[model samples]
Target: MAKIIPFKAVRPTRDKVTLVASRSYQSYTQAELEARMDYNPFSFLHIVNPGYKYHKDIKGKDRYTLVKNRYLEFKEDGIFIQDEKPSYYIYKIVNRDGLTFSGIIAAAGTEDYQTDVIKKHEDTIEYRENIFKDYLKTVGFNAEPVLLTYPDNKIVANIISEIQKERSEYEFTTTYRDTHYLWKLDDKDSIRTISLEFEKMKTIYIADGHHRSASSVLLAEQLKSENKKHTGNEPYNYFMSFLIPESELKIHEFNRLVKDLNGLSKETFLIKLDAIFRIENRGNQLYEPSKKHHFSMYLDGDFYSLFLRKNNDAFKTALDALDTQILYKKVLEPILGISDLRNDTRIAYSHGKNDMATIKSKVDSGEFAVGFGLVAITVKELKAIADEGLTMPPKSTYIEPKLRSGVTIYEF
Candidate 1:
C-alpha cells in the first residue's frame, strides 16, 4: 500500500508566485536565461543560477551552497512562506492547447519505491543520480515534485471536484500562456480521506522525473546510513510527488530521423522493409501513423505508409511489442546497420507534437535521409511495461503537463 503524507511546503508568496515560478533551468537557452535574470528579479532562475548575481558562472558544490543562500534570502525577504500546518496541495494547470491537468502534491514514501509499489518504466543514470543526490544533500529541499500516475479512483476524483469549487490560494498565468492554480487542503479530514484513498491503490507508475525520484531515494538511504538514531518518520523517508490518475496522462510518440539508409540502395531498402511491412506510396500529401504496428515514412521526397505484416513480428515481452522496438529490430539493425540507439549518431528524434511536415522538412533539407512516424503508445502499454520491470527505449514517449520549479518546496 502507498503511504502519502502532507508537508508544510515552502511556497512563494501569492503576489510573487506568478513571477517566481519557472520551468526547469535546462529548458531555457543561454540568451533566454540571461534575459530572465536581467529583467525578472523575482524569478526562480535567480535562486538556481546564483552565480548570475556575482556575474560569474559557478559549478558543483560551490553553486549548491550559493543556491541554498539565495533560497534563504528569499525567505528572509518574505518572498516565500511556509505553511503553518502540513497540507496536501491541489495543483491545476491549463496549457495553451487547452489541456487541463489536476493532481495532488504530497510527500510519498521512499519505502514504497523500495518495495516497487511506486513503479518506473525508465532507467536512471547512476552518475547523474549521484550528482543530484549530492546537490539535494547540500540544498536540503526539493522544488519540483516527481509526477506519478495511479489507477483512477472515484473517491479521489470527488475530493478534487469539491475542493476546486472554492477559491484558490494562488492563481496566475505565466508568459508562456499557461495558467496555474493551487488550492490548499489542510483540513484534517480531507487530508486523511485523500491519503487513505491513495493507500487503496495497488501501485503508481512514474510518468516523469525518474532521475529525481531515484536521486532522492539514494539520498535518503545515504542519510539513514549516516545517522545512528534514524527514524522512519524523518523527512528523508519521503520525497515530494504529484499524483494523478492514469487517465489524465497525455502520451506522445517519438518520430525517428536517420541520416542514411546504410549501404543499401533505395530500391533494396524498400525490398528488405517489404518482408515485414506492406509498403504504400502516399505521394507526399502528408501521412501519419494512426494505429499500432502502422508507421509513416519519408524518403527521397516521397511519403510512404508501412503497415506491419500480420503475424510477421512476434513479441515475448511488452518491450518487444513496442513500435519503436519493432522498427529497430526489422529495419534499423538488420537492414540499416544502425545499432546502439543511445550513442548512435545516425539516429535523432522529433516529438509527436511536431507533425509529419516537420519531419519531412528535416529529411528534405538533406540533414536526414529518412524519417519514421509511429503511433503513440497507450497508458495500458506503459503500465504493462512497468509491471514487468522493463524499461522503454530512449525517448520512446513524450509526456505532457511539464511541471514548473519553485511553485512548492519540500524541505528536510
Candidate 2:
C-alpha cells in the first residue's frame, strides 16, 4: 500500500504569497529573471538565484550553500513562517485556459517508491539524480512537490469539496493569469480519513518529477547510512508530493522535428515509409493525428497523414503500443538511422500546446527536414506502462498543472 503523511510546511506570509511564489527558475528567460530579481525583492527567484545579488554565477556546493542562506534570510526577515501543526494542504490551480486541477500536498514515503507502491513511468538519469540529492542534502528543504496521481476515491473527493466551501488560506493569481488556492486541513478527523483512503490504494503513479523523486530516495539512503540511530519515520525518509486524481491529469504529446533524413532523399524516404504505413499527401495543410497509431508528418513544405498498416504485429508489450515507441521502431530508427533520441543532435521536441505551428515554422525555415505529430497518450496507457515496470521515451508527454516554487516548503 502507498504511504503518505502530512507535514508542517514552511510557507510565505499570506500577505506576501503573491510576490514570493514563483515558477521554476529554468522557466524564466535571462531578461525576465533579471527583471523579477531587480524589481521584486520578495520574489522566490531571489532565494534560488542568490548569486544574482553578487552579480556572479555560482555553481556546485557553493550555490547550494548560498541557496540555504537565502532561504534562512527569508525566514529571519519574517517573509516565511512554519505552520503550527502538521496538515495536508489542499491546493487548486485554474490555469489561463480555465482548466482546473485540485490535489493534496503531502509527504510521500521513499520506501513506497523503493517497493513500487509509488509507480513511475519515466526513467531518471543517475548523474542528475546524484546532483539533486547533494543539493537537497545541503539546502535541507524541497520547494517544489513531485506530481503524483492516484485512483479517484469518493471519500477523499468529498472531503476536498467540503473544505473548499470555506475560504482558502492562500488565494492569489500569478502573472501568467493562473489562479491558485491553498487550504490547510489540520483537523485530526479529516486527516485520518484522507490517510485511510490512501492506505487502501495499492499504487500511485508519477505524473512528473521523476528526477526529484529518485533524488529524494537517494538522499534518504545516504542519510540512513550516516545515522547510527536512524528511524524509519525520519523526515529524510519522506519527500513532498502533490497527489491528485487520475482524471485531473492533463497530458499533451511532444511533436518531433528532425534536422536530416539520414542521407535519404525525400522520395526515397516516402518509399521506405510505405512498407509500414499507408501514406496520404495532406499538401500544405497542418494535420494532427486524431487517433492512436495514426501520425501526421510534415516534409518538404507539405503535410501528410500516415496510417499504420493493418495486421501489423508490433503490439507485444505495453510500451510497444505507445505512438512514440512505434515511431522510433518503424521510422526513426530503421528508416532515418537515428538511434539515440536523448543525445541525438538531429532531433528536437516541441510541446503539443504549440500544436503544429512551431513544427511547421521550424521545418519551413529550413532548420529541420521533417516533423511528426502524435495524439496525446491516455491515462489508461500511462498506468499500464508503469504497472508493467516500463518507461516511456524522453519527451513523450508534457503534463500539467506546472506547479510554483516556494509556495509550500518541506524541511527536514
Candidate 3:
C-alpha cells in the first residue's frame, strides 16, 4: 500500500500568488527570463536564480544558501505564510488548448520507491540528485510539485469529486490562458480518509520529476542518520506532488531537431529507412505520426513519415514499442551515428507547447538540417513501462500543467 499525507503548507498570500508563480526555469527564453526577473521583484525565479545578486565567482546550486535566505525574506515580508493547520490542496490548470486538469496537492510517500510501489520509468542521474537534495536540505522546503500518477480507481475519483464543491483557497486564470484553481481541504477527517484511500492502492508511479523524488529520499536518509529519534513519517521523508489519475493525465509529444545529418544525404537516408519501413511522402506539410512505431519527419524542405515494421511478439517490451525507440533503433543509431541523446551535440528537443511551425522554420532558416515531429506516448504506455520497471529515452513525453510554484510549500 502507498501512503500519502496532508501537511501544513507555506503558501503565498492570495495577493502575491500571481507574481510568486512562474513556469519552470527552462520554459522561459533568455529574453523572457530576464524580463520576468527584472519586472517582478517577488518572483520565485529570484530564488531559483540567486546568482544574479551574488557573485560571478559562485555558480551552479552553490548559491542555494542565498536562495534559502531569500525564501526567509519572503516570509518575513508576509509574502509567504504557513497554513494554520495541515491540509490537502486541490490544484486545477486549464491550458490554452482547452484541456483542464485538477488534482490534490499533498505529501507523497517514498518509503517503497525502491520496491517499485512508487514506480518510475526514468533513471535518475546521481549528480543531479545530489544537487537538488543539497538544495532541498538548505531550503528546508519543497518549492515544486513532483508529478505522479496512479491507476484508475473509481473510489479515488469519487473522493476528489466530493471535495470539488468546496471553495478553493486559490483560484485564478493565468495569462497563458490556463485556469488554475486550488482548494484547501482542512477538515482532518476528510484528509485522513483521502490518505487512507491512497494507501489501498498497490502502486504509485512518478510521471515526472525523478530528480526531486530521489533527492527527497536521499535527504530523508541524511536526517535519519543524524538523528536517532527520527520518525519515518516525517515531512522530509516525502515531497510535494500532484497525484492525478492516469485517465486524467495527458502525455504530449517531445519533438526532435537535428543540427545536421552526420554527412548523410537526404536521398541515401530515405533509401536506408525504406529497407525496414515504409517512407511516407506527406509533402511540405505538418505530418504527424498517427500511431505507435510511426514517425513524421520534416527534412530538406519536405515532410515524410517512416513506419517501422519490426516487432518483438514473443516478448512484449513496453519501452521497445515507443516511437522514440523506433527512431533510435532505425535513424539515430545506424544512420545518424548519434548514440547518446543527452551528451550528443547534434540533437535538441522542443516541448509540446511549441508548434510544428517552429520546427519547419528552424530547418528553413538553416539553423537545423532536419526536424522530426513524434506522436505522443499514451498514459497506458507510461503505466506499462513503469509496471515492467523499464526506463524510457530522454524527453519522450512532455506532461504538463507546468505547475506554478510558491503557491504551497511542504516543509520539514
Candidate 3 lDDT tens digits, 140-236: 9998889888877777577677777877677776778787878888887877777888888899889888998999989988888998888787777
Write one digit per residue (lDDT tens) for candidate 1, span 1-412. Answer: 8998999999999889989999999999999999998999999999999999999999999999999999999999999999999999999999999999998999998899999999999888899999999999999999999999988989888998899999999999988899999999999998999889888888998998999999999999999999999988999989999988888999999999999989789999999889899999999679998999999999999999999998776789998998988998888888888888887999999999998999999999999999999999889999989999999888889997888999999999
Q: Candidate 1 at 152: error in angstroms?
A: 0.8
Best by TM-score: 2
Off by over 4 Å in 1: none
**Would you estimate the TM-scores of all the predictions?**
0.98, 0.99, 0.94
| Candidate achieving higher lDDT, 1 or 3 | 1
Model 3 spans with C-alpha error above 4 angstroms: 54-62, 310-316
In terms of TM-score, which candidate is stronger, 1 or 3? Answer: 1
Off by over 4 Å in 2: none
In Å, residue 317's CA in model 1 sits off its true spot by 1.1
lDDT of 2 at 277: 92
How big is the positional error of residue 397 in model 1, measured in Å on the Cα after superposition?
A: 1.0
